[model samples]
Target: MNGAGSAKRPATGEAAASGRAVAATRTGPGGRPGSGKSSEAAEGHGSGPGKSRRFQAVTRDTARPEGGGRAAPGDAPAPARQWPLLAVLGATGLGLLLVAFDAFRVGTLLIGLAMIGGAALRWALPSVGMLAVRSRFTDMFTYGGLGVSIVLLALMAQPKAWLKIPFLDDILHFTVR
Candidate 1:
């Protein structure tokens, strides 16, 4: 006989079915074909303790302005509200006012001491003083003093105004320049 049946056979539906069977068996613990995932992992896709472990997530606020860039890691922390500092300053100011009403020179001395003590305390323990007197207060005090000094100098340069209230002009005209 000629070698009619000796050539390699063409792949038919039977070959396809057999190929699928081989692929099924080659899969991992799950019944799917050639998947590397485990049976437990496949079964735990939607509802299981392993859900969080299966995926990573990232989130950002939707309301950010259009031109805003990514936030820097070194951005400053939010400023804390400092009612305590305001309360302390307000109380001290009221006390000074009352004292001045009763005794002018003594009140002025006490006010000076209080201001110096406040500055010293802030210099000593900045972290604690940050809680007591906010940085804004210190800034306000510094600029306010400079502004008052400038105004007093402007007034003192005018001898006519100084003549109206000699003691008042002397007290107010305490600026170096």
Candidate 2:
């Protein structure tokens, strides 16, 4: 041999055996002869020349405000509370009972107690969040509907000499709905 043909390259000698060694470590024994490689092969997800390989390098942006950490303050949302509704319901329940039963001082006192009890119940019980977490929309509707009804009753009752209901009808109706 002379000129360009003077030299010959040596073979790597490993080929299939070398590839087998690599696959043996990465994959299990089923990757051999009769395993389920057929299905994987069909989908081009098996260890084959035609199969596509994927590599994903997980990265974090440390420059972020919280250094890309878990559960930064802004990640979680604030708990829900219908503040306006709560206040309105509590005040109206107490006011209505007080005025309606005022003729009998004992009755008025008892009604005041009941109103306080109702307020306690409303406060002690979970907000809509707990019901939503439990996927109990029915309970939410039930409690909400009862509160709406109470507000309605208070609105419809005769206006008390001490406290006049806020709106004549329009505003109250709109709000109740």
Candidate 3:
């Protein structure tokens, strides 16, 4: 008979229906599938709330950026620990307040300076607490770009332009007219 019907047969279940191989021998209370996760773990997709942490090592929590620790050490005071972030925040706040008080150009300039300062701090210091909002390269790029943009806009404010770029006028004229 060539042992045609003597071949081993796999048990049929939900795992089989979904094309997932399951360990039919592993059982739990009432002979149910244990934890219903053994199969998932075996599949290397361990994103469930179980012991298997395949690619979710930091699940249920967020991670700080590479250099997003305290500016100072553990023993230092709270303010000192996050001095860089505080300084940037303070400067930005002051700039906003000044703008509210009818000091547009100076306020914008201060805001731009604060952004540049934040970038510099993030670069020069080992840790900058909240100032390190992203990776070192991303943080630096964002801060520097925003600072330069703000400063340029402030310098080129209406009535008088502190910075003169001949090509900019040509582009403006082409676009406006």
Candidate lDDT scores, in order, read 0.40, 0.39, 0.75
- Candidate 3 scores a C-alpha RMSD against the true structure in Å of 10.2
Give me candidate 1's TM-score against the actual structure: 0.26
Each candidate structure's TM-score, on Cα atoms with residue i matched to residue i, is 0.26, 0.21, 0.66
* Model 2: worst 10 consecutive residues (lDDT sum): 3-12
Clashing residue pairs found in predicted model 1: none
The clash count of every prediction, one per candidate, is 0, 0, 0
Tell me the tens digit of each residue's lDDT in model 1 across 67-100.
1222212243333233334433664586479666
Q: Which candidate's lDDT is highest?
A: 3
| TM-score of candidate 3 versus the correct structure, residues matched by position | 0.66
Q: Which candidate model has the greater lDDT, 1 or 2?
A: 1
On the 0 to 100 scale, the lDDT of residue 70 in model 3 is 83
Whichever of 1 and 3 has more TM-score, that candidate is 3
lDDT of 1: 0.40
Cα misplacement distance, residue 139 of candidate 1 (Å):
5.5
| Local accuracy of candidate 2 as per-residue lDDT tens digits, 1-177 | 122211221111232334321122133443333332422333346354423243312334424221112221334444224342344455555656666766333334344444444444444544322222222344344555555555445434554433355665578689899
In model 1, what lDDT does residue 175 have? 59
